[model samples]
Target: MQQSKGRPRTAGAGQESSAERLDGHGREPTEDAGHLRYDDPWYDALASGWGESAGAGEPVPAVVAAARREDESRGAAADVYLEVQRSAAFQEVRRRYRRFVVPACVAFFAWYVGYVVAATTAPELMARPVAGAVNVAMAAGLGQFATTFLLTWAYARHARLRRDRAALELRWDTQELTRGVDGGAS
Candidate 1:
């Protein structure tokens, strides 16, 4: 009986030979069991920086410098963001948004809860026929849907009228600050 190279082959081993197990790369398996030789040309090309700009020699230093510049720019942008956050205009915008949202949420939730409570505790009030089969409950439920649509329209109108222009100006200012005169980070 012929013996396999390195370790002895166990009984009922799969059909793949040692060469096939090396991923068909034409490289032999190393003396260390389960380790294959790194012979792929693609990895070698990547290591040598193939297909990159011919003028830019040695990519590591350039990559490091770019990363350092990016970090510094991010730090500067964070400072700008903080300044914007501290500004009265930003504060006012946020305040207005919260002012509208908080009260609206409270009012809507109260209305919804009131409906639920009335439905549960006041069956006679809900069941009283208005015209034919339509009752107070049905009308109130339909009112809830109408209220949702109305609130949505009102919020949109409020944003368009009171908030959109201010927000847009703030965004433009922020962009100008972050990107300097030449459209690059100063």
Candidate 2:
């Protein structure tokens, strides 16, 4: 009996018409193209492994299945914990800003509105100053700019230190993964 060839030959030769119709020549097909399935590679690999196992006269053992289950559980737990830590850090930063930055910004806007109203309504009073050559509005506005700059500079320094610490921790974790001493596949 003659074995039929797999997959039909269309109206094209190698690396010419069919290549342009898909991606470039030598590119693999994608899932949406409908010519191939998503699990093709994994299923093909599994089928190939079955041939090897049959030749060796051994089936899959139960201990390997149990170990794989345990490994999958541990991996899922690690992923969940990492996600929690990431989200917790984000929430903490937002909480810190909410506790200080939000109220400060609201107070600043309120003060600004008050200043504009007072400057428009009572220019003579605002122009009078406690110190030489500096009126009350000028002093207050200058104080606001100074406070904003100091806060921004301090926050920048704090953020840089925090990021450096986080990076160092991540580097250590990555080093541990690279060592592969935890019985995990690299």
Tell me the tens digit of each residue's lDDT in model 2 across 36-109.
42221222222323212323434223233446665675686576456545765545655664666577677778
Q: What does candidate 2 score on TM? A: 0.38
Candidate 2 residue 64 C-alpha distance from true site, Å: 37
The CA lDDT of each predicted structure is 0.69, 0.54
Residue 125 Cα positional deviation in candidate 2, in Å, after optimal superposition:
2.0
Error of 2 at 146 (Å): 1.4
RMSD of each: 13.4, 14.4
Instruction: List where candidate 1 sits over 4 angstroms from the true fold.
Output: 1-65, 181-186
Can you tell me which runs of candidate 2 are displaced by over 4 Å? Answer: 1-89, 157-186
Q: Write the per-residue lDDT of candidate 1 for residues 1-186, one digit (tens) a residue.
A: 112322334656556565554532222456786554433222222344322232334322223445556667778788888888899999988988888889999999999999999999999999998879999999999989999999999899889888888989898898888887324844
Clashing pairs in 2: none
**Clash totals, every prediction:** 0, 0
